[model samples]
Target: MHNWNDPGGKGSACQADKDRKDATRIAGQLNIPIHIRDFSQNYWDDVFRHFLDEYAAGRTPNPDVLCNREIKFKTFLQAAIDLGAGCIATGHYARIRKHQGHYQLLRGCDPDKDQSYFLHTLGQQQLAQACFPIGDLRKPQVRELARQAGFATYDKKDSTGVCFIGERDFRKFLAHYLPAQPGFILDTQGHPLGEHPGALYFTLGQRQGLGLGGVQGAHQAPWYVVGKNVTHNTLTVAQGDAGHWLDALRLLTSQPSWVAEKPPGKSFLCTAKTRYRQPDQSCQVQVLDDHCEVIFEQAQRAPTPGQAVVFYAEELCLGGATIEATDAAFGGLEAST
Candidate 1:
C-alpha cells in the first residue's frame, strides 16, 4: 500500500502529521508495505490554481472536489498504477457497482456520510479502477468493526475542516494568497448597507462572519450574502427569516462530467443536491450547448455558483458540474438568467 503525500500544505501541518501517523498504523496492522510518494509542491499549486481562478471568477469554489479529481484520482491513482497496482481503494463514503458492463457510482449506505457529491467529477475510467470497501456499511457499523479490531480511530471524529486550510480563519488565510479588494455591501436595491473586505471571501447564503447587525433602517436580525457583483466589486446582502435574495428556482451548470461518460438523455427527471449532505430535490434538466440548465420543482435556497450540483436517481449517482449561474425569483419572475 502507498500513501501519496503530494506536496501541498495550505496551512495544515498538524493534520498532515496526523494523517501520516494514521496511515502508518493502518499499514502496520495490515502487514503491508507502505510507500510515501512526495509530490507536495505540485499538489498545492494545482489546487490553488483552481481555487483562486474560481473565486476570481465570482464563484465559490470547492477545493476538495478539485483535489479529489486532480490529486487523488488523477495524480495518486496514476502513481499507484505505475507501481503495478491494479486497483486503488479509498475510505470515502461512496460505492461503485457494475450493471450490464457499465460501472455506476452509488452513494454509501450511510446517507448522512455519503461523499458522492464531492466525487461527481470522477469519470468512468476512474470508477472502473477504484474501490470503496466501507461504502456498504453505516458509520456506526464501521466504527464497531474498528473497535473490534482495536483501531485507535475507532471513534475518531470526522474531519469537518476545510481540505487545505483546516479550521483556520478563512479570510485571514486567504488574504495571504489573494489580495483583498475592499468593496461595498449593497442591498438588492443597490443601496449601500456596509463595507466588506472582499466579495471573494463570501459565498451565497453565508450568514455568519458577515459582521452585520442592527442597521439604521434595517431590522435587528442576521444578514446573508445573496450575490457577488464581481465587475463592480460589490457584495449583495439581504435580511429577514425568508432571505428572498438567496432563493433560486433555476441554475445553469458548466459542462457536466457524467459517470457513464455521457449524459443519460438531453433532459430527464432526477434528484439533485446543491451541497453536501443536502436532501435531494426533484429537478428537470435541459442540456445546453456548453452547459445544462436545471429547474428545481421548488425554489432552492442559495444555489451558489462554482459549487457542484450532483445528480442522482435514488442511490445511483449521475455525476455533476460546477454551477455557473442561478435564476432568482423576483416579483414572481426570473431575476437572473
Candidate 2:
C-alpha cells in the first residue's frame, strides 16, 4: 500500500500529515509494507498554473480532474510501477474492467458517489493496471465495514468543494493568485446595475455573492449572472430567475480524450455531464477534426466553458473534453432598465 501526500506549502501540510498517519495505521493493521511519496512543489505549481490560466481565459477550471490525471494516475502510478507493483488500487468510487481484450472504465455501484466523471481522462493503459477496491459498496456500507474493522476514519465526514480552499472564502482565495479587476455589472440592455469585483469571479447561472440589492427601477427579484463579456471586463446579470440564459441545446468542446484511445466513429450518441454530480443528459456527439460537438436531446442548463464535459454510454465512461464554447444565448433575459 502507498500513500501520496502532496506536501504543497500553504494549508495542505496539516491534511497531508493527517492522511499519512491514517494510512500508516491502516497499513500496520493490515500487515502490509506501506510506501509514502511527497509530491509537493511540482504538483502544486502545475495545478495552480492551470487554475490561473483558466480564470485568466474567463473560464472556470476543474483542478480536481487535472489533479487525478497528472498526479494520482500519472505521477503516482509511475512511482508504484518503479516500486515493482503490477497494479495500483485506490479508494475512488470508480470501477475498471477488461472486456474483449480492452480495458474499460465504469461507474461505481453507488450512483451518488460515482467518480467516473473525474476519472474520464484515464486511458486503456492505465485502466488495465488499476483497481478500485470499494467500487461496489455504497458510502454507508464502506463506513460500516471500516467501523467493524476498528478504523478511526469510519465516521469521518466526507470532504467536498475545492480541495485547497477548505472552508475559506472562494473569492478571497482566488484573489491572492488572480488579482481581481473590478468592473461594471450590466444588464442585457447594457445598462449598469452595479459593480462586481471581477468578471472572472462569476460564472453563468450564479445567484449568490452578486452583492446587488433592490434597485429602484429594476424588479425586486434577486439578480443572477446571465452572461459575461470577458474582453470588456463586464459581467451581465439579470433580475428575476436567470434560467433562460442557461438553456442551451448545443455545445462545442475541445479535443476529446477518449478512454478507448479514439472515438468510435464520426458521430455517435451518448449521455454527458458538464459538471460534477450532474444527472446524465441525452445527447448526440459529432466528432470533428478539431473538436467535438454535442447536441442535447433537451436543452441543458449552465453548460459553462472551461469545465469538463464527460461522455458516457450507460454505466461505461467513454471520455471527456474541456468545453470551449456553447451556442446558448440570453434572448429571454428581461432587463427593466
Number of backbone collisions per candidate: 5, 0
lDDT, residue 199, candidate 2: 92
- Taking every candidate in turn, the Cα RMSD to the unseen true structure, in Å, is 2.8, 3.6
lDDT of 1 by residue, 116-184 (tens): 998998988999899999999999999999999988889887888575677678888777777778899
Q: What is the TM-score (0 to 1) of candidate 1? A: 0.93
Worst 10 contiguous positions by lDDT, candidate 2? 1-10
- Model 2, global lDDT: 0.83
Candidate 2: tens digits of C-alpha lDDT, residues 218-310: 767888887887789998887786667667787888969999999877899999999888999999899998689888888788888889999
Enumerate residue pairs that collide in model 2. none
Candidate 1 clashes between residue pairs 3 or more apart in a chain or in different chains: 6-40, 7-39, 7-40, 7-41, 8-40
